[model samples]
Target: MVKSAGYKMVGGNGVFFPILGFASIIAFIYLSFGDLLSVRYKNEINLSFVERNGTNFVVDGKLFYINGWNSYWFMDHAVHVDSRPRIRAMLQAAAKMGLTVCRSWAFNDGDYNALQITPGQFDENTFKALDYVIAEAREVGIRLLLSLVNNLDAYGGKTQYVKWAWTEGVGLSPSNDSFFYDPSIRIYFKNYVKTILTRKNTITGLQYRDDPTIFGWELINEPRCITDPSGDTLQDWIEELSAFIKTVDNKHLLTVGLEGFYGRKSPKRKTVNPEFWAADMGVDFIRNSAPSAIDFASVHIYPDQWFKRKSLKGKLKFVADWMHSHIEDAEQVLNKPVMFTEFGLSDLNKGFDPSQRDEFYKVVFDVIYESAKKKGGGGGSFAWQYLVEGMEEFNDDFGIVPWKRPEMYRIINQHTCRLAKIHGAYKPVTGNMNRICNGRW
Candidate 1:
């Protein structure tokens, strides 16, 4: 070896001296330029979980009222690499409108192309897309509520679980409705839950359980046990799943994505508005949300489908009353924070007037605000869905794109502003004490 700079002509140590000089130079360069190769994305780390304060949701010691949207398509579309920009645009637009939260689908099961391919199997690419979706939501200062499964069978829901049971030679009948009570079917669902809670997000490098941007987990979307109209099976399932999720991610809140069904327990409630009962869905809002493990309550409203025969005014009245009853029950009975997780009118339905839809939204938002103001009114709500300009096909008449429906957007924007103001202005009863005031113990 030839003598280099910093190498002295030592007796029989020329090679060692040159190697030491090169090692020192390499270390110096690494110390000076270490961060150049590593790109650090400036991600807003939101670590505050929404905690219940009586009829309110408190985030970071402040009352958190959800003025949000149900964007169930984000996970579905984001899985396709090319569809990411659209999601970014939607979140950006929503954040600009003063919307603070987004409820989106976190799991797609069954098919080979689904997020959870089959039971314990998951598609890494699809999951990474969800990671990006969560990261993007956090980047824009929006919180998320991720639903673990769906009631309907379109995107590998309970029906798929039943099919999985059939394939495994389980003795149970292959009816999707049995998903609530079937032990063999339940095992697969539990496995999926563990996967979601324990997996680390590839994009954010944070475990899903520890992410604060995630406001909570919905055990299942619009859960229903049609066979058992008494609501025992569904309620039992809610208790089990809610407890399991709490064990996995105690930091996040938990809710059952129920459709506000009164069930057969309260004949008066069921008969108040026969349509509200959703007898086919077979769930009791009170029973399902009463479990200690369930931190909050959720309900969806669809007057167009439920009351197809009623006039616009009649439908509006039913909606107002429906909200009033739910709020009262939540305040007096459940005492848990309840929200309208899904509500929107379809223009394609009978008496499809754009103005009626707008009016309906006004009624719902007004009721939500009024309820939130008192001890136990509706705390937050997510309209049926929000779509961008080009994604019109996703709109089954209920989806509202801000630019397309300027008037609806105006109403949504106004209510979002009003709700945000309410959330910002209200002080929590448990400020600094960190106690859940007025909440059910």
Candidate 2:
């Protein structure tokens, strides 16, 4: 039975009249596009993947820039009907701010409060929750970058996969790091890929695999094989898993999430950041992007994390150099489009102030815009997060809730407007791309 059946999302019309004007608009979008979703989505013409040609993202054969955010909590929060109004508000807020894409988690496989209860088993309620997220994003005209799994233990990621294997008597190493090499663990992960890829949304009646609103499928979120610093273990796993995903769903682009780490192969390149060598995650950016199925290269930067004791000025300079080196590598060596997929400074860091944070964002956004304008350096970026007013409890170091920090929101909106103008010059096949950003479309 479809759990989403007969359950109306809270931010819809008649029964739902929001106190906020944006909420009302969201209701209109939800009701207006209800059964005619596919037609409405196509009419908007925003459903194409931001494909890579040479070293830039092309949408409908024209250059596309990615001005987006990492809202990893959308699916997690939208599972409950009552909580959906918040999701609606956030997406509505993002649209208002001119964000073009969003990167979020598509997998929650683990034992403690897991989305997938066991291997080949899932909680239908949580699955329907994700269905609502995709449907709403389509309505709001924002594309998604959906990651399949997590490297960290926080959300039942690789560690949980290994635990499932151990319970089944696979008895691989006692370490979660072996998730990349263990055959049984790999099989379990592949099963998850097939399940999510083939899933038909309870709300839209479209297979997840066929949904063009999804910009791409990410194999994992920040994959690292710390146990094997040679980087071969992680590389082999990426090649095998990425190829497997293509077999399951050949439509969408695929990428491996790396932290712009330069591994041992090019010892000189590894010197780009001493922290890359010190962290010992064994990720070689050039070798990692060599797989045919991997369509684009991704990198994340956190100067605060890399140079914990550095002043704000030093951190900003590190960020500039970090971005330049990766952009150059993406152009010269990898010959693929590149994204500063993740980069942000946290408020919790020492010497943290609103002005400094704003400056940091400016420096990063400028790097991306400058690279993209030159037609090859950097494609786009997603700051650490986009949080809502009531979600302050989630405040780690990177959360940027627009209501609390209006200045940050202003900075983000400026980037959006600048990118929109640049996109207009590119003359995307969509024709009304400018109107799309201005919310007129």
Question: Each prediction's Cα RMSD?
Answer: 17.4, 7.7
> lDDT of candidate 1 vs native?
0.72
Name the weakest run of 10 consecutive residues (lDDT summed) in model 2: 1-10
Root-mean-square deviation of Cα positions for candidate 2 versus the true structure, in angstroms: 7.7
**Candidate 2 C-alpha lDDT tens digits along 12-113:** 111222234445545654663343333333434446656778887787798888888888777776765655766766776676666767888887775332
lDDT, candidates in the order shown: 0.72, 0.74
Local lDDT at 269 for model 2: 56
What TM value does model 2 have? 0.86
In TM-score terms, which candidate is top?
2
Once model 2 is optimally superposed onto the true structure by TM-score, how far is the C-alpha of residue 198 displaced, in angstroms?
0.9
Best by lDDT: 2
- Candidate 1: the clashing residue pairs are 54-438, 371-377
TM-score of each: 0.84, 0.86
